[model samples]
Target: MYAFEYKRPASLAEAAQLLSGDDEAKLVAGGQTFIPTLKQRLAQPSTVIDLGAIGELAGIREEAGGVTIGAMTRHGQVASNDVVRRVIPSLAGMAEVIGDPQVRNLGTLGGSIANNDPAADYPGALLALQATIRTNKREIAADDFLTGMFDTALEADEIIKEVHFKKPDVGHYEKFRNPASRYAIVGAYVTRYGGTVRVAITGAGACAHRWSAAESALGGNFAADAVAGLTVDAGDLNSDIHASADYRAHLVKVMTQRAVKACA
Candidate 1:
């Protein structure tokens, strides 16, 4: 990796200022993605703004209406949080399956969401849970936050501070992952709240996308059999060495059904 100036900011404001000052500066929360990019020479940033010293960017807050997870909160924390498990078990389950112990201990929710990897677990849960991405500039709905593969709606220098997830009536996540990498080959999250239903799929397309047909069918009837007749085309799905686009499409339905069963 090329030499780069590193700045450890003690506060969110300072981190934001440093990021705003240098266009080529990258934010380093957990460094799982950034470190790899640096090692591969895929990114040559002039500066690296480390947010580890920013205490404001860590922790989990449970409220009556919902829960707010600080951006820099690590996956291990989320996976084991008793409060998170009680309130949003699906999210806990998703977090628990995020990588091996070392990666989970180091990977932060903010980093994962910011990277916007197509196979990342957080995006599907975010979309299905109707979560909100709270950034330094504004709060964006999960549906609007993700753009495409490795892309988001965040502007330059914008840093995510927290994510808010609504309390659903019931929800569950099921992922068929690439065993070696632990990245999703195909994943599904199904959430039911009041009379509404949402089904989100990841690791299958350009990005995590909601299954409108499944949602519509399942919304009308929250049952595993509700989605049996529905199908998604493999035309735009991802095809990697781990799994074909068609295979990923098949997994999407299977995972969705499993998620529904788990939710039930």
Candidate 2:
């Protein structure tokens, strides 16, 4: 990696200040994804601000209606937290299947959502459960947070503080993971809350997006058939050597069915 100034901020306010002042700066959380990119010369930030030293950005708190997870909470921590497991089992299940033991242990929730990789798993859960992203500057709804592949609404200076997810009565996340990296080839998160049903799909599109047609069909009747009947347009889906757009669309349907069945 190229030489860069490293700042270990003790508070979110300090981190934001450092980030705002450095035009060619980047946030380093778990370094699970960014480190590799830096080594490969794909990203060349002149300054790296590490958020690991910030004590306020790591924990799981159970609230009355849901749970709030600090952005720096590790994937392993989320997968194992009793409070998270009880409140959002599907989220825990999704965390359990992301990457391998090493990656899970090292990856942070903020890092995952901020990276917004096209094939990442967390975005689906965040969208389906109607999670809110709290940053140093402002709170953003999940839909508004994710803008595109490897993108987010976060400004260069903004830092994610935590994420709030509404507790669903029942929900499940299912994914057909890429064999090598364990990234989702196609993943679906299904959630049901007081007659409302939400279904979010990732890994197939340029960014994680809700399957509105399927959500509407299944909102009234929560069933595999309700989602299976609707067709997902493959016009903008990711297509590569591992899986074609058509195949990814098929997996989306299959995985959504599986997720709904699991929710049942």
Candidate no. 2 TM-score: 0.98
Distance from true location, Cα of 142 in model 2, Å: 0.6
Window of ten residues with lowest summed lDDT in model 2? 227-236
Runs in model 2 lying further than 4 Å from the true structure? none
Clashes of 2: 0
Q: For model 2, what is the error of residue 69's alpha carbon versus the real structure, in angstroms, after optimal superposition?
A: 0.4
lDDT of 2: 0.92
Writing each residue's lDDT as its tens digit, candidate 2 over 1-264 gives 888888899999899999999899999999999999999988888899999999999999997699899999999999999999988988898999999999999899999999999889898888998999999889999999999989999987889999999999999999998899889999999999978889899999998999888888888889998876688788889999899999998998999999999988
Give the TM-score of each candidate: 0.98, 0.98
Q: Please provide, for model 1 over 1-264, each residue's C-alpha lDDT reduced to its tens digit, 9 standing for 90 to 100.
A: 999999999999999999999989999999987899999999999999998999989999897667899999999999999889989888988999998889999999999989999999998888998999999889999999999999999999899999999889899989998889999899998999987999999999998999999998998899999999988899999997899889988898999999999988
